[model samples]
Every structure is written in structure tokens, then in C-alpha cells.
Target: MIEKTISGQDALPNISDAERIFAELLTGLAAAQPGFPLAQLKTFVDQEFAQIKHVLHGISLLGQCPDSINAALICRGEKMSIAIMAGVLEARGHNVTVIDPVEKLLAVGHYLESTVDIAESTRRIAASRIPADHMVLMAGFTAGNEKGELVVLGRNGSDYSAAVLAACLRADCCEIWTDVDGVYTCDPRQVPDARLLKSMSYQEAMELSYFGAKVLHPRTITPIAQFQIPCLIKNTGNPQAPGTLIGASRDEDELPVKGISNLNNMAMFSVSGPGMKGMVGMAARVFAAMSRARISVVLITQSSSEYSISFCVPQSDCVRAERAMQEEFYLELKKAYWSRWR
Candidate 1:
């Protein structure tokens, strides 16, 4: 909604869609738990909706949605859902405490493109205000930036958040529940014959995720791997199924390849010329330019002759990648010493 508003695809300052969705959610919650405090939930939702409206109004005035505003909006959604979940748990006779991770647990930096400050987060978790006896229902994805602004971890960040929390708390295992049962030989939807993987090493899971497997966020494996914490990918719909386990050791399988993953909408760029041969730091310079542009290179290969280097990046980054290369190698291109192709 924020994106659409900023792009002029949505009416400025309009939050009716968010309003209707939350209303339905609250209505369902009320129906599900008649004894629950629906009034309190409604009040909380109203407060959030008002704040969202204020942000939308600011966006209208600025004609843009800044990272701060975007992150705040994302935090609000997570906050509301966590609150609702807490209410449901409370209604079930559990003593639930809704903890905002930003306020009580995780501390992050880089605002919208946030990464957890592990030391700070661990310190906060150690000094946590939540009672140990209560069922702690903490908000995921959202964290407080260094400036105390509400910020979000990146996409599929709840998994990353869980992993970070597991490592910080030194939990025995981290379970990531999703729609699918677990990791498979390939995406089961595309490859009907794909076999369900029982277990895989953290390295294997990370590689698969980096190459486009959707079971876990690529960064999710980092903290767990570092801590040697086991991770389980389970199906929410089928709890009885023994989902894939990811740990320090790999399970022996007869098949050599554990899974097959593929990335789509890729744009390949090639740099080739006689001037490229035996060029010291040439490859380094090529990647350094990409680093400066914050564009991730998915794959790279060099010719045996060392005359050319080819690399792939997401197609969406083609324009920026091209611009960065042009700027970085302006002299070489101008001198006709090397050529670039996409």
C-alpha cells in the first residue's frame, strides 16, 4: 500500500484497505474467542491505524515514502499480529505477554535495511523485562534501530529473527514453520518427483537458499551455523510430518546432490578483450564496482584464457550494474581496450 501510494497507483493518504483487513481480522478473533478482550484489541488497532494515517499524510506531503516510514509501517503490521496472537493464547488459558522485540529484545542498525546488532540484542535479551514464567509472544521482523526508530529486518526476516533469537538465547533448536513440509530434492511444485529431504547441513541449506530455495532465508543460517544450533523446517499444516533438519552434520543420502535450486530473471554480463588478459586486480576491480553499487553478483566465471570474465546478477539490477561498470571502466571503454556485453 505504501509503495502503491508513493508510485501514484494508490490514492494518497488512503488507508481503507488496511482498515478493512484489520477489521476482518479482529472480527474473526472476536468470534473465535468470545471471552477475549476485543475492545482492547480494537483500541490497539485504532491507535496503529491512526499512526499509519499520520505516516500516509506525511508521505502525501513529501511525495515519497522514506525508509523510516516504510520500516515503521512494517513494524505496525507485525505488532498488530503479535498482539492478536497473544490474545488468542490468553483466551486459551495461557498467561501471554506480548513483547515488542524493538522495545524489549532485538536492537538493529541500518534502519530499513537493518541487521541485528548481536551484542546489543543479546544484552537486551539478558536484561529482558518479560517474566520467565509467562508465555513470551514477541514480535518478529521488527527491531529498534540505533536511533530508537522502529525498523525491520529484511525480506523473509522472521526466520532470520528467530535464528538470531535462538543463537542469542542459546536455544537448542530453531523451528521455521512454513506452508511446505520441508526442503526437497527440488521445488516439489516444479519437480513432482522431488523427494523430501530428511536433513541437510547448515552449509547445504545456506547454499540452497542463496541459490533461490524459499524454505529459509539465506541469512537465517548464519547465526545458527555460528552457534552450532540445529534448525528444523516444518510444515505448519502437517505437524505430524518429520520436516527437514539442518544442523552441523549432514545426513548421508545415496544421491549426491541434496537439492536443486534455480534463480530466474537473471541478466548475464560479460567483459572481454585482449587487454583483460593477465590483468592484475582486474577481477577485483570488477567486483569492487558491484560492491560500491550494492548489487549482488549471483555467479561469476572466467575463461581459461583469462581474456574474459562473465557474471550474472538479478535482471532487476541490470541498469545499475551497467551504469556502475561504465563509470568504473570509463577509460578502458573509451580507449577501446575492452568491451562489455549483456
Candidate 2:
């Protein structure tokens, strides 16, 4: 909706879609408890809405959504959702404590797309703001950046947040509740015969997620794995199902390949020529260029003859990768000693 408004495709609605949905949530909660403090809950909603509107108005005036403003908007949305959940739990007579990741729980490295700065975040977590007894409700994706400004972990960050929290709190296990029953040999929607995996090693889960398993976020395993914390992937809709558990144990008698996964929208780049054969530091130089451009290489392969090296990156990074390689291998290309292909 914010994107649509910025593009002049829609009127900025009277309230954000989130606010409207949260208002309906408030109404439902009130309906369940006639004596609930509806006014108080509405006030919380109003405050959150005001902040969102303020950010939206800024976007309108600027005619662009800057990274900082976008991050702020994400933080506000997560905050509102957590607040509503807290209100609902409170209405049911539960002692709920809302913990804002931006304020306390997480510390991230970048403005919009970010990685958790585990050292700093773990330091903050050690300070221990989480209440021992209250039912804690946390903003899933928002975190504080190095500037103490609001930022977010990249897509599927909530699962990363859960793993970080579980690791920091020294929990025995981390459970990721999602729509599917558990991780499968392949995405069940695409492969009807995809088998549900009951358990997997941490390395196996990491590989599966990195290769495009949608059930677990790619980075979610890092923290938990580092702490030796087992992670359970379960279906929220079918809690009784024996979900997939990711841990240290490995089954030697199991199939060599436990799962099959694939990444889509990838572009492969190849550098080949007689110049590359037996060329010392040639592959290193090629990858250093990608690192400088901040392009993540997904996979790499080299020929036995050592005449060529090829790597894959997301399709979106194709242009940048091409430019980086061109600049890095300018002399080789100019002299006709090396060739490039995509």
C-alpha cells in the first residue's frame, strides 16, 4: 500500500491497512470481553497509526522512500502488530510484556537489508530486559542499527529473530511454527510425492534452506547451530504432527542425500581462456571483484583443465556482476587472453 501510494496509484487511505486490520482485531477482542479497556487499546492503536501516517506523509513530500524512512515504516508495522497481540493476550488476563527489537532485543548491521550483529545483540541480550514471568511479545523483524536507528533483518527475518532469541536465552530448543507440516524432500506444492522429513542434521538443514527450502529462512540456522540448540519446524495448524527436528545427530544408514532443493532466478557467469589455465591467483582475483561489488556468489565450478571458472549469482545481480568482472579483467579482455559469458 505504501508503495502504491508513493507511485501515485492509490490514495493514502485514511488509515494504514495494518491499522484497519488491527482496529477490527480490537473490536473482536472487545466483543469477547464487554468490560475490556477498549479505549486504552484504541489509544495504543492510534499512536501507532499516527507514527505510520507521519512516515507516509514524509514519503509523499519527498517523492521517494529512502532506506531510513522505509526501515522506520517496517519498524512501525512490526511494533503495531506486536502491540495488538499483546493487547489480545492482556484482554485474556495474561500478563504480557511487549519487547521492541528496535529498543532492546536486536542489533543489526545495515539500513534496510541487514544481518544481525550477534556480538552486539548478544551483549544487549545479556543485559536481560526480558521479564522472567510475563508472556513476552516481541517485534519480530525490527532492530537497532549501528546509528541507534531503526532497521530490519532481511526477508524471513522473524525466524532469524526467533533463533537469535532462543540462542541468547540458552533455550534447549527452538520451534519455528509455519504453515507447512515440516521440511520436505522437495516443496510439496511442486512435487506431490515430496516426503516430509522428520529430522535432519544442522548442516543438512542449512544446505536445504540455502538451496531454497521455503520452510526455514536461510540465516535462521546460524545462531541456533552455533549454540548447539535443536530447532523444530512444525505446522501451527497441525500441532500434533511430528515436525522436522534439526540437531547434531546424524544417521549413517540414512540416504546419502536427504533432500533435494533448487534455487531459481540465477545467472551463471563464466571466465575462460588459455590465460586462466595455470594462472596463479586468477580465481581469487575474480571473486575478490564480486566481493568488492557486494554480489553474493551462489555456486562455483571449475574445469579440470583449469581453463575456465564459472559461478552463479542471483539474476538481479547480473548487471553488477558483469560490470565488476569487466573492470577486474580489463587487461585480459583487451588483449584477447580471457573471454566472459553469461
Candidate 3:
């Protein structure tokens, strides 16, 4: 029997949890299925895998990541779950590091000796400056308003955390592992034959994310776009599936509609005024302050006249934004353009 070797750079990139599982799968096959040609043997899953290889067909990572390359995982506090994932990646000969976002988050979590609140956990996960080539983030749940005082990334923060981390690191791309096979044009849960998109532009994915396809985090596209990072939404549950790709690089074969992503518990705000009208850098100043406060902008729209820019954000950030506007733009706040949809 011919022996196939997987090592060094070739083995490094495929060391993620999903890919490691694929290795375990191969081992099982070699043991139980015996006498098969193991050398030159390849693992091919659904049509999705074929598409995945095709997408990366031309793109190269300089040279595959070295076998001993490292990755960093950030979580709200120290988590066994993130630690476990880090271990999985490391075993495949990768160097992995796990960082608890901040001291406060960890101190409270450590006191619990077991569990902690999700929002404080996510807020504490701002990406680190130290580099690890690859970054992974996790979400304990889907959504939340922190202590009823701030809107946290909520349910899908893991995905957002990944994107945010990628943006921070300026990595080549981010790969998010979820349960679903990939991004479907329609909810496969609703429609059995829903078409899967091979690739989608950031704008298309963002629009779909707003609708309901859960592959990309609804709140992550902005950070991703800011740096033009590419993301692959693949299944951790089914690593063989062909996952969808999101980013600007899919310049070819772009589609008008990609997938549908949705947000529940969303709030909208509308503002209009002559003060807002003919305003110089008014919207920029508003958003800048929100960014400074670590408030995330969810959705936004402006009047045809450019008089105002109204945006939706986590319910938690609303009050902070309002108070900031009041204190900084008191005259504008008194006669400010403002309205909302809860």
C-alpha cells in the first residue's frame, strides 16, 4: 500500500476543528475500511467541498501556513469551550493561544467558578494587537442588551468576534464554522431545494444578513468591509459541505441577492431637521462618538436632502448615544432630529 504523507505547511492550514475532524474521519476509514489505497487518498465531501476548493482554486496563502503556525482565540472570559477548540487546533501541529478579553470579565467569571453572563463576556472580547495569523470568536447565545445598559453582539457574537478579530489582524480571510451546510438563497429549513451561493459580495451578503441567512453575522459586515476581508462560512457540524464565501474578492459571478439574514429585537431610529440639513460632518461626528463609546451601528438611512442620517443600533447603545448627543450637541439635541422604532 502506498503511504500518503500530510505534514508541515500542507497540514497546517487544515488543522482547524472542522478540518481536524476530517483527519479523524480519515483515520477511521483507514482502520475499518482496510486494504484501500491510503496513499494518494483524498477526502472529498459534498458538492460544497468541490466549490470550496474551486473558490480557493486560484487564491493562495503565499505558501500554505507553516505546520507550526499559530492562531489566537478571544473569548469574553476564559472559556473551556474556546480552550477545547484551541486544543483541537493545536494538536494538528499548530501553535494556538487563548486570551480572555479583559481582566474585569475574567475576575467575575473566575468568581463564578463556572459560568458568566454573555454580554459582559462579548463586550470584553475586543480583538488583541498581538498577532496569531488566525482568529476565532465564540457566542454563548444569539442576542442581548448588556445589563440592560448596552446592546451586546448577542447570539451571533462568536461570528462577529471572528470578523472583528480578522479586521483587527488584517488577516487574509476569516472562516466561521456553524451548524448549517452553507448560505442558502432561502431558508433550507423552509425550502428543501434552496440554492446555495458559492460566493457573494459584502453588500449582497449584508443585505441577506439583514434578511435571515445566518452564515455571516448580521452585524459583522461593516467591520469586514472596512478592511475588505474575505470570509468563508462553513459548517463545523458537517465539514464536508461546500460553505459560502463572503467578501469583495468575489468580484466575478456577483449576484443581486445572495442569502437572507435576519435580526429580531432590532430597533430603528429616524431623525430629520433643518439643523441636520446643510450640516457639515454632522453624521460623521455622531457615528464617531458612538464608535468611541464602543457602540455598534446596526442599520442606517438618510433623508434625500442629506439633512439627517438615522441608524439602528443595539438597544443598549441607544441611551449612551442619546446622552452623548445631548452633552456634546446640546443645541442640536434640544432641536435635534430624532425618532425611533422599537
Candidate 4:
């Protein structure tokens, strides 16, 4: 039996719609009288189930590609998230293995108990099972930590997980299926005429990801870059579309700027004073304090005179970061070496 438990306090409402409806039925029956037409309720539930099943079957029938491709499918949610995809591939006589990422990591003795040797573990697993013609589907992001505790890879983590798997398996390419066609010149919602990019280098992709592009996580490109693997971002609803290819720089000349990315709700902090001029290690000291406080600096700009430095961080972290700076530079402030401004 699969044992699933809610974690966070606000996670109790994460049940499926079917489960919620069944609960309503139980509550209604409990409040009703002895002759409350139990048979009618059962018939209604059966009809609803049949209708839902038919709708799901219809959706599953939409994509029926005859050609089979070997891949490591790392999905967003639980197994049900990729049920239709699995069905379509299986129908085409493709052998697929639905792997539990956490369990697979444990099986290879990589994570959860000791140091994570991702490369070694993946090499062993890839060499052992799943024939050349078969595809492997896995739940992404969720894994075991060094102490055997559950860990998630944070935002856009599924994309990162997919890249990791592809690098380890030495796959020809990795693809990310999303709602949009591919990475756009700007967010379509913000810029109505935002154009799609056909291709970009891995360095550009990483920079865009860090600067607020949501297509892939910043860490997703690290392993893939090490192996010089190429990644494609495609839309699940538009499988035939040629999506953006992220890899090494092509020999052909291209535009200087491929896209624009932005993040909002940020506060800027500046450090400036006459004493800061020509001071060695002053910038390092300022940043080290933020690092110790676990504050992420979004952007940094230093004056050419070297007397002032300015940086931006999320508004949520500004207050904590300020306090950390005060504590770290108390001596400097007392000596009138620098002043902090927000």
C-alpha cells in the first residue's frame, strides 16, 4: 500500500477532487434520515466515476505517436501526472520503467545515508537496467538528503532533475515540456509581442534563469554543461513544434541580446563613505555578512571610484539583511568608515 502523508500545516487541503466529493457524500449521508435514498446516491457516484473515466480516456487519445524514443522522463508531480504520456508510449509498444527517484537514489546507495555520488550512482544504474530501447519515467526534485531525510530541489526543480538524469545517462538530449512554446524574448504576459527564441547557449540560459526567467532553474545547466549536453524546451500541448535548443554557441552570428528578464519587489542597499576609497577587502566583507545571514543578493553595482557599493535583494529579505550588515560592520560604523543606506 502506498502511504502518503501531508507535511506542512497548510497542506491538508491538497486532496484530489474525487476524494473531496466522496467526503461530501459521506457527510450528507450521515446528516440524512434512515430512508434517504442510499441506492440513488450510489447510482449517482457510479455515473460520475464513469463520466470522469471517459473524459480521461478522451484526453489520453489525443497524442498517439507511433515512433518511440528512449528517454528519462522526470515529471512535475506524482505518477498520475504522466499517466496519459505513459499510456500513449506504451500503446506504441515502447518499454517504459516508472522509477521513484528517491527510491532509485537509495537503491544505488548514493543519497539519504551518506555522500551523494550522483555521477557514480547514475553510471551504475544506467549500466544495469532499462534496455537501450526502453524509456525511464521518474518523479523529479524529491530526493533523500545526507541524513536520509526528504529534500526538494526548489523552484523549476523538475527541469533541473531532468538535466541531471540526462547527464548521468549520457543521453543525446533532454527536453522540458511546459505550457508555452519555448523561452520568449520577454514574458508574453508582460510584453504581448514577445517573440520565441529558436536557440540559445547554455551560458545565456543560466544567466536568464538567474535573472528571473522561469523556463529552467539556474542549477539545471551545470551538469549538462559539464557533459556539453543539449536541452530542448517544448510545449506538451504542441509536441510537433520546434522548441528552443539550449547548448553551445553556434558558429553563426546571432543577436547580442536573446531575451529580457526581470524580477520585482526588491529593495536596494548601498554602502558608501570616504573611508571606503581604495580599501582592500571592503566589498568582500560586505558580501560575507549577507552570505552568513543567508540573504541572496540579486544584483550588485560598484562605483568606479570604489567608494560606494550598491546591491539589491528581495524585499522580504531586506530587513534581515540590514540587521546582519549592522551587526557585521558595527566597528566600521563606530569608526565612521562607512554608512549603510536603504
- Estimate, for each residue in 93-113, the C-alpha lDDT of model 1 and write its tens digit: 888766567765456555666
User: Number of clashing residue pairs in every model?
Assistant: 0, 0, 17, 0
Top TM-score model: 1
Cα distance off (Å), candidate 3, residue 132 = 16
lDDT for model 2: 0.80
| lDDT (Cα, tens digit) per residue for candidate 4, span 216-288 | 8777888788789998999999988888999988425667878899987898888898888988876687689
In model 3, how large is the Cα lDDT of residue 89?
56
Q: Is candidate 1 or candidate 2 better by lDDT?
A: 1
Candidate 4 structure lDDT: 0.66
Estimate candidate 1's alpha-carbon lDDT, on a 0 to 1 scale: 0.83
- Who wins the lDDT comparison? 1
Between prediction 1 and prediction 3, the one with superior lDDT is 1
Each prediction's whole-model lDDT (CA): 0.83, 0.80, 0.54, 0.66
Worst 10 residues of 4 by lDDT: 65-74
Q: CA RMSD for every model?
A: 2.2, 2.4, 17.6, 12.6
lDDT per residue for candidate 3 within 1-342, as digits (tens), equals 001111212322432444456456556655655443333233332232344334333223333322111111112222434544554455455555455433322212111111223335434544344355644534331222222221233446556656655665567988888888778888887778888788888888877776556666556677678788888889898998888888785546656545554566655656665666677776687688777765667767788887656777767667886666566566666654433212
In model 1, the Cα lDDT at residue 265 comes to: 96
Clashing pairs in 2: none
lDDT of 4 at 212: 85
Root mean square deviation (Cα) for candidate 3: 17.6
